[model samples]
Target: MTVLQSFPIPRPTTNPYLIMLGEALRRTPGVTVLNFSWKTALFGRYDVYHSHWPEILVGGRTPLRRLTRQALALMILIRLRLTRRPIVRTVHNVERPDGLTARESALLDVIDRQTTMRIRLNSTTRLPDGERFKTIPHGHYRDWFARYEPQEMQDGQIGYVGLIRRYKGVEGLVSAFRETEGRREGLTLRLGGNPSTSQLAASVASLADGDRRIELHLAYLSDAELVEIVTSSELVVLPYRFMHNSGGALAALSLNRPVLVPDNEVNRKLSDEVGSGWVHLFDGELTAESIITALDAAAVRADRPDLSARDWDRAGIEHADVYRAAIDAGHRR
Candidate 1:
């Protein structure tokens, strides 16, 4: 079966999950991936259309470009319905992205109604009522960064990497770190990734004021640099305001580093799956005590986080099965 993915390979800003999934599908026995393009999406030959984040298709840097993309999105939606092609959307987030224009929201609503199957990264993800879905655990990053030289774990380093968005609560993380007793023990905080806005960067900087131990690499990190930041830390902290599933958390575990995240059913399941001392959870908002307690857990973690359940080969096969099932359902209809 041939599937057209809404992601481009070899794009510098492309997420590693998309890149790895494309490769996995290519390696599968009877599956083919038709890389996305405006020309391909509107006119190309493929069996099923696979969308990861459909919002990007209708967004642009300027109003004129945004309108143009929105027009294209509408055209593509019409073409998909006319051709009777099924769409498989991977549910990365349960909620519709915030800050969508009315037109964009309506377009996505149509896309959602037209969707054939939904792929959830975890079983705990609640779908819209009675939506047909399958749980395909997000794959590990162990194989993707295998070629990079590993960074030695630092004793008292706590690191946060990935896009610096307000919803991610980087400022809260810095504030909590500042209040931690670990600072007297030489515990350091490293912040990487470009901030979503200058104001957000300034806010975090203000929080880190006069603190020499708080290192900031407020820029986009290459794969090697991301690896260095994550692998070098004894503990990784992700203090998101809300998180059901995170590729960042999985990446840290895949690199054999423990993570501290908020306490929730998804995280509790992750902790149970990966084993003790790997996933430290805190109740309510992150605090100084949470950082110190999780850091202590990181200190004595004897074994690597178990990521055997996140194999890419298995993901590829499962994805193929989903595509086949969607096609068969289309035929029956």
Candidate 2:
């Protein structure tokens, strides 16, 4: 059997789901993998064409460019339809186009009409055209966790990772870290990721100049550096104001490190379903006092066993099943 997997290039972060999907397909006997571009012409030879990307509707200026691209994509879909080869789309996120113009809405309608199946990461997302959709959670890069070495505790050391965006609640984390800085012995806050130095400094500038516990690594981090930072810390805090599903949180969970997330409904549901006692949810407002209390609790339970084994394998097997089902459905049609 032949399978063509199409993905977008030039993304800053490596997508672990694509990696896992490729690996799982390779492991299946009698299956051949093909990586192709979005504009590639389809010969009538391939058995399946599986596309992975967030569902996007073209908007903004350059309607000509958009039409050209859409024409090529439509040609590929027509080929699949003619050959009866199943076209499966993995929906990472079906983002509404910025400004939500009429043209964008129409383009989305076109895509909904063309695609056959959608695999959703979160179960909450609505289906396209009321068609069949499968829910598969994201997986972790298990190999990256092997390089991590636990760091010696320095009392109140706290760490946060990932892109330091406004919605990420970095300000909350900093305020919480500062609240316990002098009150606890050896209290330190370490911030790492690809945020601009000026932006990061501006966020935490209110802290005293002499505060030694705060360390910031405001640059793109390699896998080794990320693993080291996550493993060494007593607790990894995700204080997200909103989370659909967190890839970073899963990465830390794979390393058996405890994570402190806000007590949102989503986090609460995941914690209960996964039996992950390590995920602590904050109550009341996400004030410095509330976050500090959660962090202290997380510090005590940092050594908890990793709860990732089941979820990781389950996500992998679920994708494998989706691939097989797509293949079978195509053959039947």
- Model 2 alpha-carbon miss at residue 201, Å: 7.1
Question: Could you give candidate 2's per-residue lDDT for residues 59-153 as a string of tens digits?
Answer: 32577876765666666766877777777777765464356556546655665665667787766666646687788766665654565665555
| Candidate closest to the true structure, highest lDDT | 1
Per-residue lDDT, model 2, residue 5, is 77
Question: Residues 22-97, candidate 1, lDDT per residue (tens digit)?
Answer: 9999999999898999999998999999998999988888999999999998999899888888999999987878
RMSD of every candidate to native, in Å, equals 1.4, 3.8
lDDT values, one for every candidate: 0.90, 0.65
Q: Worst ten-residue run, lDDT, model 2?
A: 52-61
